[model samples]
Target: MNKKKLPLKVLKALEPFVGMQGELFTIEHPGNNLLLVKDKDPNSKFYYTIEKHQIRDGKDIYSVIFAPKNDKEVGAYSTTIGADDITTTFNSWVLFLENYSKVKSFFDDPILESYQAEFFSNFEFVDEHAETNPFQTAEILQLDYLLEHVSTRLIELSDENNREANEVIVAEIAFIRESLTNRSQKWVVEQISNIYAKIAKQGVPFIKEFWAEGKKELIKIGIKALIESAQNLIS
Candidate 1:
């Protein structure tokens, strides 16, 4: 399929969320007139696609579909807005970028969240099995390195004087380590869901503060670590 580069206007609109680093993600035309936007972050493994469709009223609309790269069973999260032409399609994308957080929350809905919980629970089993599987030795080592790196970055993000945030971070890291070590699927699933809910409800905004203050590098490190660990286990 011939790939299409992002339009200048679309890039400008996505700048606030993706930063000025244009090379950090991949943009392609995935054929059938769809534009695929994928994050280059190995940990993220998320992508968005924009397409145009016709409705019963003979009107055209532009829609954006966001989903994780590896998930095949779960349906993609999508939204559509009225658009008369390609320019309007870009405009619709801009509007979506403006309300990105709300769109993200939709993808982070309860059903998908539960799926994530179950995935992580299974991941714990993989971790345990790695101990006896010589073929998985390298991957296990990489997972350990990534988790340690992430833990250090998270600690740096936390303030020693801020008891509350520190407590959350500590609990989160502890749970991560525990889940990696334990084989209790039910408990692991619950813990994963609880931690995810907490982060969604509180962590994003909290981390945004650091991002606003030019702490994006540190934040990226922490996020990368988490993403790498997840990818490693899932792979």
Candidate 2:
């Protein structure tokens, strides 16, 4: 069984901006910058670390954290950026938080409540454990049926307009489907994480591959169903 590592594309996108100094600049790949947006308590968590510095001008200087964990110990490395103006740093941070928040909210779909419930039901914790394993609680086998349904619907909807974004979305869905069918647990988690990371880093181009053929009747049905569900939920 092969395990899926994190998306190299996303990590590549993050590299240039990871510890860069800028003025009036935007950090495009803000999704992986988890420290600013996520909750800090033990119950909820996000990865990464932050170090603040007092610059010569008394402004806040920041660094990026790099860490990978194993069963035995937690280790970390930090990279410091050159310098950023006050306004650019603040704006960039806010934009990063907003983007990550949106990605997080999408995973909170009403459809996932039951899957999450099932996940936590069998979730285990060791009181003496020092390192946290984020991947252990997942049970994507439960997601297969729902994911296929959503994928088919999304593919149909994309057929209607043949839009690039919809196409890529369809490919992602297929990737998830194939992973599920093969019972590739690590691949499933990696794909989901990549989806969020893509949305955070590159936005919707994450789904451009599937929309190439242009609108189909199935897609129209899917689009209608999706809209109807949205309306009913809102109502």
Candidate 3:
């Protein structure tokens, strides 16, 4: 049996509601026992939980919890998924929603506003002569990293005669990829669908006609997710 890979999509989908303080449990991927948690800080003080255990029917049920770091708040939520849920995208999204909903406390609290200030303060040194401001710096660095990632894999797909034009698409993909990750998944999926719609208008023969472009979008979406997941550590 193959161990389930950590659901990157689920992680991203839950970001808005859960923030960086949570964990994920799975029985299908190599990293089945994935835990997404945050370090202790004044502003955002909680460790998200993702735990998996077996049910009476011999199915895996995942439970999500959020516990305050310095306080005595212990909240719990759980959901059980059957084999069918593990086999389809629908189940994946449902599972994500369950995990996300468990951490909704972060969203409901008015104190998060105060934490947001401390959140920025913790990274104050990054602003002090950091050579790159957050916007310009994160954008270029992320784009460059994205370009390198997609180029290595997609350049082989480009026609040798059209390498120049292909390079332009390559650059554009890098620019827009991060946009997907920085915002919401619904936004990113819509963006991806929209770009494909435009490419379809051009009568591109195949999905590969827009493959490189779509990938750029995906990379941006992926990286932003990764950063968001790890934000608690930085804070």
RMSD of each: 17.1, 16.6, 19.4
| TM-score on alpha carbons, each prediction | 0.26, 0.25, 0.22
Cα lDDT listed for each candidate: 0.44, 0.38, 0.40
Instruction: Report the candidate with higher lDDT, 1 versus 2.
Output: 1
Candidate 2 error regions (>4 Å): 1-141, 159-162, 181-184, 196-235
Residue-wise C-alpha lDDT for candidate 2, range 35-102, written one tens digit per residue:
23222211223334444333546543456553322223335446655344333444444454344445
Please, what are the lDDT tens digits per residue for candidate 1 over residues 103-183?
Answer: 555345565455445435433343343332222334334433544544565566656554575566556656555444432
Segments in model 1 whose C-alpha atoms lie over 4 Å from true places: 1-135, 160-162, 178-196, 203-235
**Best-fitting candidate, scored by TM-score:** 1
Most accurate candidate by lDDT: 1
**Which ten residues in a row are the worst by lDDT in model 3?**
21-30
lDDT of 2: 0.38
Error of 3 at 222 (Å): 14
